[model samples]
Target: MQKTPKKDKEVINVIIQEYQKNDLPWYIGYSGGKDSSSMLKLVFNALKRIEYFHKPITVLYCDTGVENPIVTTYVYETFEKLKKECKQLNIPLLFTILKPKLEDRFFVKVIGRGYPTPTNIFRWCTDKLRINPVKELIDKDVKAVILLGVRSSESEQRDRTISKHKTDNEYYLKQSGSSSNIIFSPIINHALEDVWLTLRYNELPKSIDFNQIRMIYKDAESECPVYRESKGSSCGNSRFGCWTCTVVRKDKSMGNMIENGYSELKELFEFRNWIAEFRDNIKYRCSYRRNGAKGLGPITLEGRKIILDKLLKTEQLSGLNLIPQEEINRIYELWEIDEINVNYQEKRLTTTCIKHG
Candidate 1:
């Protein structure tokens, strides 16, 4: 390991002190990205240095079920290694993976219910796939502190939001119709270069491959897939998001990753592009919203069936189970119900017309 800088040491020391002082359980958001990786390293190091502190520290990972295959594998392997190491060190560390409910799954919403592909304005994926799952866990814990890897230097709007919600050692996150939770961003002030340097110099767990992470960074530019809009930038342009994301005009991250030698992902990339094309065509989308408004809504039933067939073909080509069997079953059930309802409505309309005539 390289020598740690004075500022880095000071920041680590502050983190240690805060962890020691807080009695509340700590939940670190691990998105399997660079910033989250750095934050976890700092916290883990701090805990290692402590003698007998006993407040539980849990790392929470929200698996959207649509993450890049490479990232998902890396994160799971790293977590398993961290669990083993923490056990050997007698460190009170726990890792939990949170997943969205079946009803809220990507395919269930898109293909099952004929929902349109997510767009910049109608980005319904984030809340259902990412935030709500994690938030559900956070809400269960009373007075818990959630640690995030967000950095102020990442964007101007982020800096302002961080500053606005700044507290003594954490930020306040207001949950909808629920009590607020505290969020601590230890690396909020750190620049991008500082983050990379820390990851390079710090003695991270053996499970973490800094070099692999560096490669991913080189390819993707940014980590988290969920889009966050900033001044002159957006997550779609720079960050790693679901391969099937249609919000961005282009999925540069996945394209770069393929260019960098992950050729197996080509099928997935092509499928994502096809989804975007399908969503853009007016013939595939419904002319009215779910509430009967004259606006864009879910895809038409025929469009949904076509999408499912194509998706299944993509899965076969990619050699990966893109959608879970349970989700597929649920989608089929929904389609049956939709068909039944349509038939019943048509019969009822015919009967009423005969009576009136």
Candidate 2:
């Protein structure tokens, strides 16, 4: 099936020219998500069919420490399968993983430092998880060209976002800080239907399963963690962010996955729902947060109705186990940090009082 879009043929040609270049490192970024999957198929097919594309193409996937179980599995399987397949075809398949240092996961910050679950305005999650990981992948090659499967038609906001980066010549090519670091989005012009059409006609490897995750997006359920410019509800769902995301109360993607017979993962969803309900409970949330609500600026991002007592209750009720010893240990460390700071302030006050007296 010639899913090569008619309008985007020129973009493909340019991408092909870039690939044909002798010196540049072609690092195609894959998220194991649909958009990236389509990009993978296109680039893989293009490379496989043409001798010039046979040059080394690094298929980089950044594992954001916390991804959907299915997504994680898919990524690993896809990387391995692609590598073997490339070996058979004599093409070098390069896969890279970019995860944050130990201090960047949900537990380290949320359970450790008492930072609340990220809100829309302050999405501390994305820079650590999504953007940072992608940057790491790009940083691998000295003269790297990062191929992303970002399409203009994905969203109005996405279209506008990509437009700003457009140079007169390239559709989705942008310069990174280094002259060697270049990002390319070849499928920027392809339509959604075109992507699906390509998938429907071609048989993806048994290692890759798109059928399972399709339901998350099947019903117009989109809650993107990425900052959206629109006031209306976010137009992307089944995203692979925190499971404890309290931002979107009704997570259509999680709901879809659960309702679709992922019974094993049902408890996590239930736990998330309970956390959202109990978020406002003052009893569970500390009255005086570690920073005392004042230090964290005017807005008190200090409270979460997930106290130790409530967590015990939640564990009993859900029959779910939180990470043992870790959260408790983290809370204790933070409390100590807070206590030391409080004591220093007290000592300063006492000296000042004595000085005045």
Candidate 3:
């Protein structure tokens, strides 16, 4: 018998191979981004071929909770349409929405409790907002295999030494020696052109429309924030997230959307800008440092001195909803830690995970 050639494996075919596993649950890390969409298409096609196994494949959408309404609506609609159609066709596809804890949202932490915005030197949200929640979805009982959309072409950071990756010629898994969950990227071989060509050619069921997504991706100018590398030119669309991300200096995406007349996003945009300004004001933080006395650990990031009184002032001035007392109390508790010598960076995650509207 001749062995099947690895290069001959189509994206959909590679994904279909997973269906042979009656034991492990399949997890797709769908961020609703373009590459992820292409991966999603392959997954959809593959699952359709498995007529015998009625087991539902989990399509997990890690909602930042602050995603642009446009993307948010598209993601939900696509999932709903697929869920209904698959159920009707007896295809057994289940869509689940996963999100970072509410307190982990940027607005909740930064605007509510004055946690500083995320930066390259420190990105506290990845685990809580992107990676961790997805891991929880995999659960511990099974040999979980996750399907990630990441391709080597996306960024230099992603294009590390090939040996560092776990690819058997055609696909790469996120596990690439990092994450604990077993993950795979089937479209790792396909280029941007192939993905677009495939999407353009595939006559998707009427329920699974990508019209809105097409338009948004057309005008999108930034990369996805979750895995986006700092100091690189923006790729993909919408700054890797909602137009409201304050982590970047001046959210070009949100401003562009507003220029494009997504005026409905006005509230969200204003909220983001306010958060950026609050982060810029280092004086609102503790000059002495998070520790009772600051000597030196990591240098204090700018705007580490903002206190609660000013946070209230920012609430009044910026019209942002005030932070809940629970989160403020949490931040205060964190401040007591002598090890918190890193300034605003140290609190980014802790505060993001506690600040509630």
Candidate 4:
């Protein structure tokens, strides 16, 4: 561990002071990524320092269901460890895992509803899969201040957005629509190097093993599946997200993992690339948009069925429950509806031909 900087200490102190001053419930958005993990460590250390800290701190994690298998395991294990630690320390820390509704699941959308895999321009996955579930939880507490690990140094666009909405004292105010909720980006000013330094030098809770993150990523910078409402940009080159994400043109992160001896992920990487390739092929798409316009629409019924069959085969090979039973049931229901509609159209055409003859 390296030496802790004075500025880092001051940032932690400010977080403590802010927590002490407010009776408003605090919700920390934890994504099991480097930034969120660092934020959580700082918050835990701060709580330990406060002599009579009894305020409840809620940690929210959004699970997209399609996340890398290794990441899913890490998240579950870390949360369980944190809960045990909190119990021993008598800290009021609650960790909750948020998940998308059954109907909104990745397989359900792609196979049941025939929605195409998300792309850079038509990326519809984020809002339904990542944002809404977490937002529903946050909305429950009207006075909640969301703690984020977003650093301005991450991107130029992010920096400009942060500077635009920040308060005089540096607290970032949530934009117009979400005016009820405030954002506390404690590490906004911290550089990328500062972030890693703080994570290394600080005494983190036993529940968190920062080294695990380093081992998994192997020099790749990663972020949890936090939904950014701003149309800033996609996780193009970033190594952390749903394995099926096609917004980046290439999943460099997963490719790197496979090259780094995670051979188990090779099948998933292949499936992901296959889906991306299929998505670009006009043969797999419908003739019209859902709104009746002549544009790219959901995958055709035949396309959906073929993809579903392939995905199930992949699931068997990987020995992972990629699609749940509920989603399978829903897909059958959708297929039945499509079948009935097609039958009705055929019968109508037959009757019309007989009358004309």
Candidate 5:
């Protein structure tokens, strides 16, 4: 282990002070990435220093179902280890895996509803998949504090956002879209190196394996912002998101992982590329909107069927259960409903023509 820097110590002290300041339950947004991991490490150290636990500290991990399988497995395993270790250490930390509602799942919207995969303009994924689940849980509390791994130095837009939401205290910021919740970033002042130092040097919580996380980083890149607090906030080339994500022209992150020895990603990568190209093909799209407007709409029923077949084939080839059986049942139900609607419309049109003639 490397030497503990004075700056990391200062951050941990600050965390301890803030944690003791209120009885409010704390929610830490964890993406299982380096930044969040480091922030969590600091939190662990702070908790260790205190004699009494004032309130609950819940670590929230959002599993969108579409997350990279490799990362998903890592996070799940880590959670198991964390639960056991925290129990042994007598740390009153709670670990929760939050998930989007079934209807809001990625495959449900895309394959079941025939909606296209998310793009820059129609990035309907972020709120439904990542943000809403967390918000739903947090809002259940009358008021709470949310700790995030956000740093101003990550981007200019982020810097501006931090500046805009600046509270009297430098460590806290106004939580966007909610008056009941406040945002606290313990590592607000930490640079990239500082983040790594926090993770590597912290000895508590014996659950986290920094080297394993580092190995993942060596293959794939950084996380996409888990929560979109602001309207114009970017996703930051998110690697941990849905394997089927097509928000970017190409998923370079997955590609890098594949090249770096995660060969299992090849089929998923091919499928993602195929879906992106297939999405824009007019033949596969409805000529009219779902509301009967004369404009381009969702993928046609035939297109949806083709995509599902391809997805199943990919799942079989990759040996990964990409879609749940529940989702498949829902998709079939939706297809039946859509077909009934189409037949009803055709019959009505035929009757009108006969009457006019």
Candidate 6:
């Protein structure tokens, strides 16, 4: 057996102490990325060293449905193996995949309700797609500790945010807008190399292919937060998000993944590139806001239809299920509602103009 490093041992001991501190269920926010993977590994080792399981430790993964297909497949497969092996090993770890509500799904907003693709200024996808689902689940518990894999070294913005949220314990943080639950980052102090070391050294739960993660990282370098708490935090900067993300001027990571021979990403990449440009085309957007105010607003009904058509075409070309059938149904329902509202607004304007004339 490989020996654990002194730092890792220290962190694992702290994990055990924290685990045994109270009856509060522990929820680990896992993204299947290096930092989260390391945190999970440390927690797993801590559990192995202990004798009795008093409280539930659930691992929560948010699947935005639009996550990069490569990472998504890896996570799904890893979870299957983890479920089986953890049961055999009696680790008592529960794994759950959280998803956005139908109305909040990416396509439902963009293609159904005519939401323009998210730009940095108009970014709305993170809250609806990623954070809300996790928040809703955590809210069910009276009080819980959320374990995230966020690191201070990722960026200066992240460092400042972490420092601002500091709790009495350096490893813990107070979650914004929530008084009930607190955040715990096990690998908060770990540098980037330290994170990789954790994955490299701690090899238990062989279900997680650390090597495969390394290979993926070679092609795609960064990760979006699984649970976002602060506005200053990092996301969608060459990290993974919806393949259709347009917030970043360019999605260098996905581009790199394609160049690195992830051929499956080719069609999706092209479609994303097209849509990023497409969202900016004024011809596809309504001149008035959804609220009837004069401003650039949601995509026009015709724009939504065109986007849906192209999305379907892309789906066929990529051989991937880009959007779920339920989302499609919801999109159509939203379209109906929007069409009625648009007609009503037009009629009101016409009536006012005739009276003035």
Clashes of each: 2, 3, 15, 0, 0, 0
lDDT of 2 by residue, 21-129 (tens): 6667777666666666766766655555466444577776655544555556667876787777777875555667666644666545665555555555545666665
Each prediction's whole-model lDDT (CA): 0.75, 0.55, 0.57, 0.76, 0.82, 0.82
Per-residue lDDT tens digits for candidate 3, residues 251-271, read 676667777777666666676
For candidate 1, the per-residue lDDT at 58 reads 85
Looking at model 2, which ten-residue stretch has the lowest summed lDDT? Answer: 348-357
Clashes of 6: 0
- List runs of model 5 lying over 4 Å from the truth: 219-221, 234-236, 342-357
Model 5, 246-354: lDDT tens digits are 8888887788888889999999999999999998988777666666565667777777899999999999999988999998999998777776662323232221101
lDDT of 1 by residue, 1-357 (tens): 578755568778878888888688788888778888888888877787889876879898878888888888888988999999988987777999989999999999999987778888777887788777877887787777778777878876667766665655542332223444666778877888888877888875656677978887675556552212122233444458677888788888888889989987899999999998888777766555666556665676677889999999988998987998999999999877766653212232221001110
**Candidate 2 ranges beyond 4 A from true positions:** 1-14, 52-55, 140-143, 175-180, 203-240, 277-357
The C-alpha RMSD in Å for every predicted model, in order, reads 4.6, 6.4, 7.9, 4.3, 3.9, 3.5
Worst 10 residues of 4 by lDDT: 348-357
Between prediction 2 and prediction 3, the one with superior lDDT is 3
In model 1, state the lDDT of residue 67. 85
After superposition, candidate 1 runs with Cα above 4 Å error: 168-179, 225-238, 342-357
What ordering of candidates by TM-score runs from best to worst?
A: 6, 5, 4, 1, 2, 3
lDDT of 4 by residue, 1-357 (tens): 566677678888988899998788888888888888878888887887788775798998888889888788899999999999989987778999999998888988888877778876778888788877987888888667888888878877677777667777685646435767778877877887777777777765777776787787665675744645344434554667888888778788888888888887888888998998887667767655655566666676667778988888888887777877888999989767755652212232221001110
Off by over 4 Å in 6: 219-221, 231-234, 342-357
**Any runs in candidate 4 off by more than 4 Å, and if so which?**
1-4, 222-237, 342-357
